[model samples]
Target: MKVAIEGCCHNKLEEIYKALEHIESVENIKIDLLLICGDFQAIRNTEDFKSLSVPAKYRTLGSFYKYYTGELKAPYPTLFIGGNHEVISYLWELYHGGWVCENIYFLGYAGVVNFGGLRIGGMSGIYNHWNYNVGHFETLPYNESTVRSAYHTRKYDVYKLAQIRQPLDIFLSHDWPTGITNFGNVNKLLKTKPFFGPDIATGKLGSIACDELLFKLKPKYWFSAHLHVKFSAVVYHDERTTSYSESKEMSSTSVENPDEINIDFDEELNNPDEINIDLKDGVNQEEKNKESNNEKTLQDYIIEDDKKEQIPCTKFLALDKCLPDRDFLQIIDFPEANGKFEFSYDEEWLAITKATQEYLTLSSNAKPLPPDNEIQKKIEEELRWVQENISQIEAGLVIPNNFQPTAPAYGQQQTFILQQPFKNPQTEDFTKLLKIQNKINPEGQSPIRQD
Candidate 1:
């Protein structure tokens, strides 16, 4: 169960793979998977660069094109969440989560997937108060404001995570969980990015929703990025009836009735095991009521359920973005969970995926109906294939300067690939994004690979 954690990739896929290889050789341990926090910049083609919302000076085709064009393959299984900087349209296509390329998985906006007996769950994007409650209205041909709002974390995703009953072994967020600054070295951070002093000092540096879930689920490990610095902290939440966080020096030893325990943790969590709000039915009436009443804040949805059994504390780490020798990555291992675990497709995600797929088939005036037997079976097959492959994704050195066949040989399972043809000119600008990626390398001098 060896795994590697990476912070913001910013499309430096080659550097990440190289670093992992170096770690493997030095530590004499093979890393099984590489989990990236965000800003992965899956710009597979020149056309995708046009879709990016970053300033013209910052836009460039990143490492994604190598894999997209089949000139290079991923060296290890890669899993990533979305951050503020991403191609919104492409991710929206598989909003319920899918394989971006062979052995690389995108967790969508919010999702839960099991890997080798480890239940990893997380929500993508940073939180913005203005866009927190808004539906995803940012479509293609994105306008300036819409483009900026595209990556804002929404309440809908947070609500979905709030409904889960199973415990998450690892939780990932693109931004640090709020109140986490209390756990790390703020003075050291201030020395690096002095502007963050106020936010860190005031406990306003990261997402409030992330902090809420951290308390509720209490996952064993919580990983984040977007800050471009590495910081580590431990959250100690022992089994107790009262709501408290160890980082804040709040005690968790007081006992209270479990029935009233959940209601005390913000809004009424109710019976988590029994509260099933049907996705197709749309937003729950309870949620709607809360929303209409005085413009419900993000804090309104931060509910923690009363646990019948105790869960352990979560170790939080926010790694630096991918760069050479900056301590932006780590290699670690975990014990495999006991008993049978479903490695693919949570029941809730399947419902959302099925619902979205069915909605696409109907005309504007038509009422959408669930797909029939044949269609249902096909969906099931696809989900299982993605799940099983991701659960056992391979890690090996990649072949350079090779290409995939347009058509597979007879009886071979079709490799899922996005067809994106673009003219690649061997010019200075092609390596612009590959150049020193800002402040971490203010001198604009990251070493180029020999490839």
Candidate 2:
């Protein structure tokens, strides 16, 4: 089945609409599903950073629902998963007792959905970075209280997935698993002071818990979008066996001669698959090997061929042509360039004529419009009704002229006062505890660490 996956749209409604429209125009294509990885809004909260209890703001899911319901004339279904910035949108839904849209499915927290006989499991939540701060003197537990709270709230999602013993076909999440690309760098940009504070010593990006689960589950495909960068990897596991045998030749022969009732037994044994540990220059050699193997799959071959065929030009071509200064003029050039032609001009008349010619060429072999049958008549009637009631449909939905708010706008300059590290006994005691914890868990647990 074909699907279109996108993320981090960031409330660019026109762009989203254009993307959907383009996808829809692909002839004979059967797009069974649309998956959004999250970050559908430009901002998480209002200008004041205060959560909107109402759903008036375009950032809210309600706004998205209304827009999509009206504009997106898709032939298939769409799914939405939450990202970090979608917290406010989710909050609005929670206040209203969850989203009410029937067509749009919200995979809140984590859930499983079946699409065209394929099972897709989605887990949405940021990494738990609070637990690691317990021992750090630079960032205390109290300072990381927000992180702790968010982690606690999402703890159930972690536990719920642990109970899932069956493997999934596709695993979708907002953040990439640990050790995947430069996710660490992206997470660091989002971390501000006074809330878990920034620790430049360690660059962490992904969730250790999520990584553990991914390793154990071993899904066929995994999708994530938090890093805003494309990354992929294949994990592998290995199985091995060993055998040994010993015999006493002379003694056994003599015993067999005395009593030919010697008995022998053999049994097969199986062991759990053991993954090879490959440590090589900060790269996971085992994963690299698996990815190499994965690249040889049938789908990879198909995708490669599709990519080759989808190129707009069959061959490189460079051509220049000059038109006569007459109203009606024809210029001729070799037609073997194998390039799609597009026209641009410095004058309005030339541009219009070029566009018209291109349009006529495209439509030359197009199917003619159907006759005014019953269905067409009905459609026309509906169109007329829509046109008549357009104003009513637009009631209370008009875009305000001066909607800008005079509040704490985004990107406002702010100053922070960093105090010297406390030298109290409590701080020293915590520092000691942190040293031990750091030894046990050397890797920092956060979305930024994934890099």
Candidate 3:
């Protein structure tokens, strides 16, 4: 079957739209199905997760249906599996059943589907952080909130999958199985320095349970994304047996013979090389056939004129920009300055609230008491004296001219001559700041900060 399996879409609506458009433009062959592994959107809004509510933001499945019908003109059937981001929606449906489109099937936690003779099994949802709270998983004494939450939740999902049946033709998961390459990229990018000499190698950021299952089942094809890096491989399995004997007496020995196994199972285990088709022969045959079939089909002939003048395909538009701009931004509302405000609030709520209240009670008596009306009037007059002094100090203060403060140019000699230092910051430092400043101030400098 000619099926198009999309990667983690992450709400790149434009790229997805273009992909669908290209699929529509294909002339002769029919597309059997379209498989979206997971992460269709970056986040599921309350309405998106609601049993059947449709929001105006076009985030829910209803919006997806609308967009597909309006723009994509999608002819073939589509299948969707949940990713970490879509877990909430999937769970909501699990708790309160919802309608899945006639053409679409919502493959929740674990399910199998048959598509064109291919048996596809999928697992979704990330690790369960509640495991830590429930005392099912132990947490390190100095565990970071973010890491703990992520790892705890993910591990739970992997553990749950252990009870599931194996031996499927294909396995689809959002997170790459642990031990696979590229799984460490997240920790690397986040600069999560290892603590207490712990092995960061084990923090591969993939599902360990998934890895075990893959090793045991060794499905024909396994596809996963979460790492966001491109990786492909073939796994092989080999089985070996050894004979042993148990003796109860000097002359009496019993041989424990295992069942006679077909050794060919090891040889037939699907390895990576099997999928690598040598295209040289196919290419030559296709070229020869093309010449013989120069007389185009009816549909091809009809679209030939339109194809010549058709606008350039939009699929080539750089998808990198769309990922963070159209996708990440749509869901993750990144706060300014390392999310200082949010972090501060979280710290207060999670760690400091009780202590802060205790401190407030202890310091309550130290706070100055309000003056009576007559005393307040006298204090107000005295405060005017302080205000006048403060204003006079402020007026007399010569604020340095921050505007274009000069600095020594490159390769300039440093001297004690005390000439005004040219304010040319180091090129690399300035460039880094400019990048960050440019993102914050998209339209160059503001008048207030320009100086």
Candidate 4:
């Protein structure tokens, strides 16, 4: 299966599809799935602009509204995460993730799904320490603070992602993992964006939460955007780094175990008002960090499964934002797992969601999550429930094609304010399938609770 990876879409659906079409027409190769790193502004109508956190000049309706209204359709099966610049109010409606439009899927604030037999996971939004430990407290009719905080990466999502013990084929994040520069070509990257020198030197360039997930998930491929330069690096998870418990630290307010290695965030980053800055150079650069004593390429240290099958080292790539002549898209083919594959809900991820939904908070207060043993028990129970109740259904694990629009499309004039979140039927149906509470909307009801 050939999949296309695009970085920082900036609401360029039409341009992206056109580029893909040109690739297919010229190379005569078909692309199966389109995975966008972030900045996919899924703005539906003019009302969504109210929650967007960009400068007034930067806020303009892009091509997504056409796709939303079914005037245009996506050429390939697409999945995207959120970034700092997004229709926050619209995205918050389907916080657990749903079809932003037919053929185009939002991966939620953070989510995992199965596509073509590959287990793909993604965490949306750029990381900020001030909001990292807080809950999903931001609501509809957002204020100045909530507008921005609504898109900030939260600990709840990261903790759920951290619970995944299964091996991942691929992982996506909007920001590069902190300390990722250490493994990549720092000198060359600094030469290009010397402005990053201070942050890089102080170990503050990327996301610490992402850094934790990288070592824990240990996916074969990791893709990111946000800093908007095309960069490549390979991370080897040897005995020294694979032990995640030893490499990460947790504060009193954190969700992880307290015994982990300390990854300190600079107190200066706590400023909630700092504007997001991007490097628009769009230059392509390669960063490779090998062991100083004895270099080891990806081939040297293939991770072995219980059956001794080799899994390659994690290959990390961060692409540039979509622009003319920018290195924003790349295509790669994965060997067929089955004759063909369709979109399906990941069982383990579903179990994790079910296990953790009760802890979902709409307050700014930081709370400790359940301990490892308790969480493992809940997951096991939920996993069994999912197998019997969901996976055993006639249609099985395949996702249903039941997308329906809940909001007005662009150019559709309206008199009333969209002050409250729309109770999307897709999300309602999804939560029903899992028998978990739909915590996305305040008024959302769960089948379990209903019963």
Best by TM-score: 4
Off by over 4 Å in 2: 24-28, 42-49, 52-65, 68-75, 87-102, 131-153, 181-203, 239-451
lDDT, residue 228, model 1? 75
The residue pairs that clash in candidate 1, if any, are none
lDDT of 2 at 245: 9
Top candidate when judged by lDDT against the true structure: 4
**lDDT, residue 69, model 3:** 29
Model 1 sits at a Cα RMSD from the real structure of 17.4
Model 3, residue 105: distance off in Å is 1.5
- lDDT by residue (1-451, candidate 2, tens digit) is 5555554443433444344444446343334555666544423213312222113343333234333233333333555565554434222222101121324455545555444445556665455444322221112122333322321214334433544445566666665554442212223223421221122113244455555556555565555565433333333322210100011111100000111111111122122111121111222233235446754887876775575354321110011000111111011122222322211111211121111211111111322222325333434444344345432353311211111111112223233111221122221222242122211112222111101
TM-score per candidate, chains pooled: 0.63, 0.41, 0.40, 0.84
Going through the candidates in the order shown, the clash numbers are 0, 10, 11, 4
Candidate 1 structure quality by residue, lDDT tens digits, 14-72: 76787778767766777777899988877754445545666666675666766754568
Two-way TM-score contest, 1 vs 2, winner: 1
lDDT of 4 at 350: 92
Better of 1 and 2 by lDDT: 1
Error of 3 at 153 (Å): 5.9
Misplaced by over 4 Å in model 3 are: 12-14, 20-28, 42-46, 49-74, 87-91, 95-99, 128-166, 182-200, 240-451
Pick out the ten consecutive residues of candidate 2 with the lowest summed lDDT: 314-323
Q: Candidate 4: worst 10 consecutive residues by lDDT? A: 256-265
Estimate, for each residue in 6-103, the C-alpha lDDT of model 3 and write its tens digit.
54654444455444445346433344555565655422223223221112343333234333223333354555556544424223222101113334
